[model samples]
Target chain A: MLSFTFWDILSNLLLAARWTVLLSLIAFVCGGVVGLLVLLARVSRSAVLRKLSGYYIEAFQGTPLLMQLFLIFFGLPLVGIEVTAWLAAVLALTLFTSAFLAEIWRGCVEAVPRGQWEASESLGMTYFEQMRHVVLPQALRISIPPTVGFSVQVIKGTALTSIIGFVEVTRAGTMITNATFQPFLVYGLVALIYFVLCFPLSFYAKRLERRLHVAR
Target chain B: MAYSFDFSAVFDYSDVLLQGILMTVQLTAVGTVFGVGLGIVGAAVMTSRSRILRVIVSAYVELIRNTPFLVQLFFIFFGLPALGFRLSAWEAASLAMVINLGAYSTEIIRAGIEATPKGQIEAGLSLGMNRVQVFRHIIISPAMQRIWPALSSQIVIVMLGSAVCSQIAAEELTYAANFIQSRNFRAFESYFVTTILYLALAIALRFVLKMVGNHMFKRRSHA
Candidate 1:
């Protein structure tokens, strides 16, 4: 039996944390792209598209991320799509992040006054032009803090991927605990790592929010 | 090869699923009740004049908010036994939920509490109400009203997040789904049905929470 030292455990956990950070970044970036499209459809003139996107958001929001991961993990194989845990985790998390980001950005977009839309329209600008030039620019400004804030959620959301055997920080912690029988230490470190990852983002978001409030 | 669907195999264990659903509801109910109570105390302390206590409560809120609930659950369920404080899965799961929600609600309720106008407190004091009376009669209700929607959403999020309790074998809905899938080898169908059940539960929970919030704070706005 090879006895592991504390440094060995810490170093291994640190290595695993890289995957956590990578997954979060990938999900956030991919989710942002998909979420933007969903937001456009959600706010578009077509009631059908709006309704479809609305359901998409509601479905994702209303269910647990774990279930979504499980579905993708299992459901894909049925459709002849071979799915690894990494593929399933990334796919489920991307969709989950997209729904939430779409909803958050929708609120920002709506915060732009109706008159701004009308004024842009009166200036002979089309809907897309009005959005691109006027509404979106303003919405973008107000959307920054909350959008940054939601990245914390995206980071936390990646933790669920561990259950599907994606071998991230939490999963690594579990593996280390089984080896060392020091679950208390391992899990406490896991929580601490997540806190370190998330707190700066949340703190900065709060600071941004306050600055926005003061600006207003 | 095209795979065949067999949702009926999953349905064969309806009794287990029902029990799992009941346990999930029980966990949420316990979590919401005690969690919100703990949150109120935390909020009150946060709003109090004690600087050290405020710092401590804020630290608790920040720590819980930053960490994932699954990690917290694992800590309580797996970690505590090392310290001679053994907890059953159900016990650990519910305790984790309470602590998780308590942290969130503390933050939520504190925001509501902070938004109360100084004039309103002064008015309540001028009415010969003691500080406690003022808080009860003049401060808390309106504060709760303002943050109720946010609180309700947080509650729904917590409920959905509780699905992870199955990992510790707490026999929640997800655990039941896993059990059925393992037995029947109908992984897709099992998870699919379980996910739909969760969606329905989430929807129903939100509706009930909205109704409860309205009913609890109805007279405040009307008066």
Candidate 2:
């Protein structure tokens, strides 16, 4: 076993944490884009579109994220689509986050009181126009807390990317632990780093939830 | 570069996959039962009048909630063994699941308990019931009923989360897939089968839990 000081282990783990943050950003942003499209499809008037999006959501949500990561990382290469660990990790995380976020934002959009839609319709507004002007504006407010909350999940979920060999905080900790044979020290720091990353989001989510509740 | 799919390799290993499925189901079942019990206690403690107990429960909840389960599992599986507390992979996985599930269950059950009306508690007390009696008769039963859906969903999440046990070589369904893929180099077919099995298991678990809840809380059927 390598003799490592506290600072040595921490510095390595911190470097790895950058990947965690980056992966979370990539996944969250990409998932947000895809999820918005999914939300739109879900709420669209076309039955086929809605059903397809519904199926997509159920498929991702019903299955394990670990399984999804495995399928992308290992399974894709077999079919001639060569993917690096980074590609597979980001793709899996994005796909998983999109399903949940789409559901969340859909609930938000649906929660915009029925009368608001009726009012927009009365003004001869198109569905897109109504959503852009009347429905989404209100929905955005209600969506903030849960969206932030879901982002925390997204951040935590990025840890699973480690299994695909994307060297994030958790993966780095694993490596360090193996090298140093200090599982407690290494993993404790890992958990602490994750706590630092996640707690603020949890606090902010709670604050937003309270504000949203009071606003209503 | 086009490659043809060969699923027969995976099909031939169906028995191994079945074993993995059974283990996953067993892990989920044991974990959910114990986890919910811990959750109820945690929730009760958090909701109790004792200030220190509330703080302890809140701290436990926050700590577990903020950390990833993979890390938590590593702490148990890898960390504890180094501390001279060697547990098998199955024990480590189940313990981690119990801890994770307990935290989530605490939150859900606490919500349910809080939703219990003051009048009902008062009525129970006025009928000469002690605190424990009132708690069991009026609070916990109704709280379980009120939170059954959320609790069941959390349990399903636990079932899915069990996939992480493969990292520790727990030989669960995902681990079986990993093994088969490594052996056969048929990754797509292996994981595809695993995913279908997981979906089927999740659906089955939800159905069974729904029936169990229905039978257990018949008095609150309207709930």
Candidate 1 chain A weakest ten by summed lDDT: A154-163
Reference-based TM-score, model 2: 0.97
Model 2 CAPRI quality:
medium
Worst 10 residues of 1 chain B by lDDT: B214-223
- On residues B1-223, what C-alpha lDDT tens digit does candidate 2 reach at each position? 5788899999889999999999999899889989999999999898899999999998889888898999999999989877799999999999999999999999999999999999999999999999999889899998998899989988998899899999999989999999998999888889999999999888899999999999999967876
On TM-score, the candidate that comes out on top is 1
- Model 2 chain A worst lDDT window (10 residues): A73-82
**Candidate 1's residue-wise lDDT over A65-107, tens digit each?**
9999999998998898999998998899899999999999999
Looking only at chain B, model 1 earns a TM-score of 0.98
Q: Could you tell me how far off, in angstroms, the CA of residue A80 lies in candidate 1 after the best superposition?
A: 0.9
